[model samples]
Target: MSDSLDSLLATADVADRRDEVVTGVREHAGRIARELALLQGGDYGSRDFDTDSGTWTVKYEGGALQYLRYDGGREEVYVVSAHSPPDPEALAEALRDYAAFVEAYNAYVESLEGVLDDVDTDFPAVASTESVAAERDRVLDRIRAVSGEMAGQLHRAEGTDYGTFSARVDGTRWELKRERDQVSYLRVGGEGGIYLLSQYGNPPATDVRELVGSVPAFVEAFNERVADLDAGLSRVEL
Candidate 1:
């Protein structure tokens, strides 16, 4: 027979454990090596102690732990995951594609630097060097936001039964989902919504076939726009 509720409650330690403490990176790799390496090791976010990294945090709840790392003056999120964080070597290999992205990103910025020489701001829309630099920064920042998100995507693939995957790029969140009849793209924001992009006959292997294959191109295409937003400076250009 099942135990009565009163009997089950006898040993439940329901009170909050105020003495619980967390410090240091729980998963050693998968995020940026240099970035994590730079973090100050000591008690940081927890109320009870100094953590290894001032900006890192680990929270335990339900049946799992959530780890997070913040960067960019702590204004940007660097890592967020609830599953296995990949080992250092694997992460490095996965980031290989992005290494080219960095090169492309820098080349784009360098070309924009030329715009500074044309100090012809008398035109109505011609921005000042400082203004252009800020705009340049915005473009690069978008690359960073997307890259961090892609890193998370590369590591976690444990769940697929739901026929859905979601990601955030430069503050804009998007979800890719496939139902039996159609594949959909959903953008999450004030006017939250979804759009049926394509109807499918069979199960759309949307994960690797779409996400992995297309993300690099997506980054490339977005990086390409920096020129039109800034004209072709260089893959970074495309």
Candidate 2:
């Protein structure tokens, strides 16, 4: 070939090589972006796209420039295109940064797993405090006060005509009877009631205050009956 022809051919070859380099580098960036998209999971929208060059995908929450994908090869391209191709060196640097970020994130997740592995499944027992003791004392004191008041009222109301004093409250029947020296009670629905023998037979107290206080079932039944002032007392008559 002539000298000029040889020179023209050489220039054409260099241009072609340059085009090839640009195309290859842009494609490499798209691959890196796709890898990032895979790691991204549900972080954003990801879709497979076919282009004149190849298929590519990129995931990002917004049109964030931080996503290193090409922009100009085809219409509505989600990745690098001819118009806004990524600088090869810059894309390489970003890929390195993304690698580091991925490594750190994975390490952080592994650290959390390690922490979980070290966790104790059994919960530690909670110790009671002075405040709890104080609260208990208050509750017992209230119960005792209520019991004393109820016993006094019942004693005043009791007469020689001790047929069974009974009341139905909240769909449950409760009966109180005077047996010689002690006043005994029975719950038609539940387990507790005064008896001559056996655990179920024990009377709450011989002393009036202790009597009402010891029988929680009686106290609860009495309280519910008396909740409506004098109306409850009237309901318990006879």
Which of the numbered candidates is closest to the native, going by highest lDDT? Answer: 2
Runs of candidate 2 exceeding 4 Å displacement: 1-125, 159-166, 173-189, 192-238
Tens digits of per-residue lDDT for model 2 on 1-238? 6987767644566556545755654565555444445555543554443343433344444322233343233322322443554444544433434434344434544655555577788998888566655654455456445444664556555544343446554555545554432344333334454332222433233322333334566566676655655675667857
Clashes of each: 10, 9
Candidate 1 residue runs with Cα over 4 Å from true position:
1-84, 87-90, 122-238
Query: TM-score: which candidate is best?
Result: 2
Query: Relative to the unseen true structure, what is the Cα RMSD of model 1?
Result: 28.1
User: Which lDDT tens digits does candidate 1 get at residues 138-159?
Assistant: 5434534565443344334323
Model 1: lDDT of residue 39: 33
